[model samples]
Target chain A: MTSHPDVEALAFFAEELLEPDEERTVAHHIETCALCAATLDELTAVSGVLADVPPVPPMPQDVADLLDRRIDEAVRERAGSDDTATETGGPVAPVVPFTRPKKRGFNGMNLPRLMMLAAAGAVVVGGGGAVLNAVMSTQQESAVGGSAAPLLQEEQAEEAVPDAAQPYKPEIVGSGTDYTSKDLADQAADVLDATVPESGYGAEEEAQDGSILIEECAVSLGERLGVRFTLVDDARFEGAPAWVLFAPMGDTTEVYVVDPAGCESPDGVLEQETFTTR
Target chain B: MDAVQELPDRELLTRHTQGDDQAFAVLVRRHRDRLWAVAVRMMGDREEASDALQDAFLSAFRSADRFRGESQVTTWLHRIVVNACHDRLRRRKARPSTPTEDDTLDVLSNDRLGRVGGGPDHASQTEARLDVHAALETLPLDQRMALTLVDMLGYRVEEAAQILDVATGTVKSRCARGRAKLLPSLAHLRNPHPPRDVTTGRGGANPS
Candidate 1:
């Protein structure tokens, strides 16, 4: 009761959020302490100020028009599915088009995006022909075919990845192999699509787990770039040893090529490009 | 359709679930204005708000049968809208496209200009809104949503709790934390003439 509580405590006091004993203590202290009392008043004034600010103007016509259109789409899609189900008299074909690109050979790969793929926990690749059970929640949710479903599906899709397994072993396509900037997009997608079988590389794989250094570097770059890269190519770009990072953003994937030694540094990203994904 | 306009919210939801197509649109028209206000405050951007609102309403439309009747239809709608905004905000956080700290301050300064120019009341009001929203952007999503519902939209704490699906105490504590965070940035905004030396003035009194 002798010392003035900090502002957070005073704020909690204003909200009656403090425990009874602490509340009594602060209440008694603020009763005599002018500064604490004034601080508490300011906190209350903050809410009052927020309350007094005017409400948003009416919903714009454009937004209303968009909403109506989206709803109409949803209704029609629903009606179509229902009609198809009644006519077929069996399981209805899924209306959601899982827009995955064709299964290209996931050969030749690298490292930065591997960290993110492991991070997203979605693609649990066991081996070649490994049924890469990507949780694919976004596409599946869109399977429900609600018109607004796709707008916020990525968040849920990102969360669907499991955190436990070390099953992801990225194929490091020939370190120091030179890649032309022209073919980098195709090369990046190849790495992104590469998956190794779950078997082999027992203790050696555990040792590679020490690539926590590379993982941390990728994480730092991801934070700086505001992208969780799903694949990284530890290959050479033009001539120098480089790390190519791939991050998917809806219909497009961004590729960042960085110096291996300086990928963690601010000037690490030597080249960056965007390509439309199929 | 005219009669559907008079239906209560729950009645419309019931009818929609029972395959009355017009009922849902009527329900949307009835509450879209208030829901828009919530979304705009939560999002701090009109386009994102519009997207979130559309996402929420369509999700509601598709899932009407899942309505358990434990809460009011409006409460249910608010929950969906808040959740939709939350998801988009989380993803946007991962993208570097959000305005940076310098941009927010630039917005605040320009808002001050609009006020000092002695423009029409409508313009000043709009600037005040911009100032408020800019300050709000700095807060964590949970705190921002709580403050938006309880303080900005003036929902009751218990009502906000229902919409947020949290305890009433949780809402109050979140509002309290948000207010504490907002105080330093916003106190000067309340004063007509902001002190030039912010470091030495009341604006500098950061309690945290």
Candidate 2:
């Protein structure tokens, strides 16, 4: 209070965090003190600069798409398993609590895998240095459905993936970084959009209003990734319904072939692949 | 459900918990950007921010029902993101980077050439900001988080207290101490007042 309001006092003064009398004392002293005044001005400017740091721009589009897909998968995985009772005419749980499930893989979205996929996602998504030295990603590199040897029969896996799934190599939009669940959904939507024209939906000119379809798919993809295939409309691809699927790898999102009459786990048809149906 | 996107975040959250699947995504979309800003600055690395963001959102989705309506969803989300970033930072021990090889001049040049005005003064401002950012990393984690929430992110001290789960006095003291350390780091950015000009022993203008 006496020995010329030190740096803390100057900062508290700048921040208005001092007692009223202390504030007055600092103000009066600063009025006569150039050094403290300059110091306060500097502190104020530092705060200004920190505030000026720009907001990271919404995880970019690709990342958002990826995030959506992941969330969808998690939602469906939970719903798919938890709702089995309802599916079998058993009593439904009265409450749907948003509690964190046991530390088990919520359809393969365990913490370690989520962390691993995020690292792989950042790299494949392309941005930021090899974050964490791709540390987590490399640990589970094979399980990610990225750079993994096919776990299923090569023929059936190839059959499931099909060359059609290869035609439209995803442009993985925006700066490659931060693949959120929504971002994954958007990536799936991209596949859906690209698949429409290929499914004989129409020509480029006819289906130009594909915006509605893409929008529908984007929203629907989020809720139905691992849940029951909600046969989004009667749209068929390669004589089968195109379904939104969450690959076991926990990151890939694709519109894959679904047989409604024989609804089955997608893991059977495809093992660790990101591809489109038909 | 067209209004789903337009509903208050609380309502959206309610709908989400009540089984409106798209509701959670809407909430995430609504708040993700600002939360991204928090995560990026706190995590101090782009990838770390991304990872933390993913965990935060997933946690938010799982924990939405736990929100007892005590605070704005934004505050709730910010806390989650901060906690996520803190976890990553702890795991990585990624120190706030020093000026190892990235010179201030290099940072200046990296700015859009035409954007930052050509002058030593503009360069100084750029360097000062970078320095402040680097300096921020040097603080202890608690001080860093407190300073970040109050100063950098513009959260109210009370709200920061809630987010950090600390007393307001604690936030105030942290800011005070953090600012005290920061001032010296930022002294060059302050008006360069000619080194006191008191070597004349005349005590400059103020003879006191």
Cα lDDT listed for each candidate: 0.63, 0.50
- Candidate 2, residue B166: the lDDT equals 73
Docking class of 1: acceptable
Candidate 2 stretches with Cα past 4 Å from truth are A19-28, A85-278, B94-126, B194-208
Candidate 1 lDDT by residue in tens digits, A1-278:
55879878888998898999999999999889977787787787778778888777888887787677656655554554444533433221121111211222224433334334343322222111221223223434543544356535533322332221122223222223366688887766665554332211111223233244444555456544334444455667988777776655555567788887887664787887766554
lDDT of 1 by residue, B101-145 (tens): 345456656656556555557766665566567667667778988
TM-score of chain A of each: 0.41, 0.32
Candidate 1: DockQ? 0.29
Q: How accurate is candidate 1 locally (lDDT)?
A: 0.63
